[model samples]
Target: MRTVRYEVLPAKGTEDKVIAHVPRDVVVTVTASPVKGLEPTLDLATRLAAHGYRVVPHVPARLLRDDVHLKDVVDRLRGAGVADVFVPAGDADPPAGAYGGALPVLRRLSELGSPFDHVGITGYPESHPLIHDDLTVQAMWDKRAHATYIVSNMCFDPRLLGDWVGRIRRRDVTLPVHVGVAGPVQRAKLLSMAAKIGVGESARFLTTHTSWFLRFAAPGGYSPERLLTRSAEALTAPSSGVAGLHLFTFNQIAETERWRCALLDRMTG
Candidate 1:
């Protein structure tokens, strides 16, 4: 069976809806902050685990004030029966305290001797607006030992992803990759999300330096079929170093789940 991982933003009143509809066995990871804070992350993970899903919550290092905060997070996750987590240097400006980046928090987690089975780190197939490509790769190298896998951020090109996989393998970064793709999202929904999530800067840097806003605003919109098919191929290939699918559901749960089921049928049929 193909695994589809869903990304959930830490929004008010969203936990119930997401947990109600999301499949039980698929991996569910919570965003550290769709807006900001640790409360939502812990809350969402607790709900997901209650619903019988293996939940992974994002721990934004910058948000943790100190070792005490880090330990509290670990303890909370452990209490929720969470065995997996995703650590990233978040978009938090002027980081909270000692932990400004993922490296520091990952080191802290290791020192705490937490028993999480899987830890994930972000990968950029598309370039980040402010960060250079070399630094991103180096971050991956720095965090590989702590992470069980790499979750590539949204990229519209599969060839780019394939090339990235090859590059990662060559670099001796053997951590499995969860190829990230936007799910069957409506055009309007994507634009709405883009607006809230700094779509302008995101598109300018990641989406070919072209006007993604203009593209989304046009009559004909976008579909991720090309990228998904290519990713499926890449994942199926031997030595590709790919693991499974990570769907950026954008909270359009039903459509994304349907898309996942249809793809599974096609692949198995």
Candidate 2:
């Protein structure tokens, strides 16, 4: 079960592109942004669901207004037949309401009888620029009870990712991990799209996951195949608890899906 993430931007034909390219039943997780608000995410999820995709819209804590708003959002998603959701602490400086981070929102969701079948929380393999490693690990431990799975943020180094997964298991967090990797994309186009959507936050993410970008930008440099080959052992190991791939398509749906299919064919050929 592969998952793909997409930013909720105002680009035309984004949903159409996704429908045309993305295979049905693959979970498409729409990203929530402080700049774009949550409407687009929710709307896109609904549209995708109607098109027979298992859509998961990110419910960022900072964007939510309150418990009431959370309930309303849950109701809407339920009505749309969405069974999965991912929660992240958004980049918003001042949160929209009581929820300051994903923990509180997740706790609230639990209190609401856990509306969704699968609740996902973010994990970091490398050190976060703003947060300490210890706190990030502890946060995962604390949220383990509420979340059904973990979706790791984009990480370039396979060794670092394997070590991070081992550390999480040692800390007693057993959530299945969906390793994040960038789908096949040109570095220039990815950066261009990110800049158009939200320069500040997107740039920060690129900085964090820049290794692959730098290599990809260089002539005939590193590719997703190399990353997968390097990481395959740890990801497939039983002890590692890796569940699946979470490709950061960056809205390059057509190209990403094509790459995915080609990779699958080659692997099974």
Best model per TM-score: 2
* TM, every model: 0.90, 0.92
lDDT of 1 by residue, 157-252 (tens): 677877777777877888988887777788777657755653213334434446544554566545677566656666677797777878877777
Q: Which lDDT tens digits does candidate 2 get at residues 18-125?
A: 878877757788887787788888998888899998888988899998989999999999999999999988777798888888999999999999899999988988
**Cα RMSD, each candidate:** 2.6, 2.4
What local lDDT score does residue 134 receive in model 2, on the 0 to 100 scale? Answer: 92
Worst 10 residues of 1 by lDDT: 198-207
Candidate lDDT (C-alpha), each: 0.75, 0.80
lDDT of 1 at 64: 88
List clash counts for every candidate, in order.
0, 0
Candidate 2's displacement at residue 142, Å, is: 0.5
Candidate 1 local lDDT, residue 41: 79
> Which stretches in model 1 have alpha-carbon errors above 4 Å?
197-208, 211-221
